[model samples]
Target: MYQGYLKYKTVIAELDSAIQLRINIVLFLASVYLVLQTSVGFKNPTYGGAPKRLPEKINCSASNRGFI
Candidate 1:
């Protein structure tokens, strides 16, 4: 595998800048689409049938001072 990579290293380096930019743009768009899908899933109430419940007591104690 190392030898194969070494052989193609120069070929990879010689790729046109325009091609690299297009590849990068495609990857960025893909990541953005994935994030949007995830956020939409979270916001869609139809996905999770049950609503989450909050705890009755709120704890804002200082752990370092041994308070709870």
Candidate 2:
């Protein structure tokens, strides 16, 4: 939330420089985790599964993916 970011800024500003450094390190790690989590893709868009691999293994006729 926007409020949460503002609150974090205020709190970090009040911390001693040493503690602020530690908090910033944690914030950086958390941001990286959030980015990786959000950027990840899935095999099935509607219901996630193993990611599609190189040279897709979907078994189907040449013209249609659903053909047997």
Candidate 3:
């Protein structure tokens, strides 16, 4: 009976250690993913292309009022 109890305890300990290791790995991966996403956003503010803007001087007088 004592030997059986010892074996059970050992198995439980191994399982607990495995679970902790898995959790640590998942946390590490999540942190890495967040860092990469943040870096990408900072590196490229506009994902599509440069912003469009009106020319300094417009040939049309009515268009100068900013009616667009």
Q: Which window of 10 residues has the lowest lDDT sum in candidate 1?
A: 43-52
**Which sequence of candidate numbers ranks them by lDDT, best first?**
3, 1, 2
Clash count for each candidate, listed in order shown? 0, 0, 0
The lDDT per prediction is 0.72, 0.69, 0.78
Best by lDDT: 3
TM-score of each: 0.39, 0.37, 0.60
Provide the global lDDT of candidate 2 against the true structure: 0.69
Give the distance in Å from residue 59's predicted Cα in candidate 1 to where it truly belongs. 35
Relative to the unseen true structure, what is the C-alpha lDDT of residue 32 in candidate 2, on a scale of 0 to 100?
A: 81
* Residue-level lDDT tens digits of model 2 in 1-68: 99999999888777767797899999999988666555653533433344545797766676676444
What's the residue-level lDDT of 46 in candidate 1? 51
Q: For model 3, how does the per-residue alpha-carbon lDDT over 1-68 read when each residue is reduced to its tens digit?
A: 99999999999999999999999999999988777766565556554234546677756766777786
Candidate 1 per-residue lDDT over residues 1-55, each given as its tens digit:
9999987986777676668899999999998877776666566755443455767
Clashing pairs in 1: none
Better by lDDT, candidate 2 or 1: 1
- What is the lDDT, from 0 to 100, of the residue 45 in candidate 1? 51
Give me the runs in candidate 1 sitting further than 4 Å from their true place.
1-15, 42-68
Q: Would you list the clashing residue pairs of candidate 3?
A: none
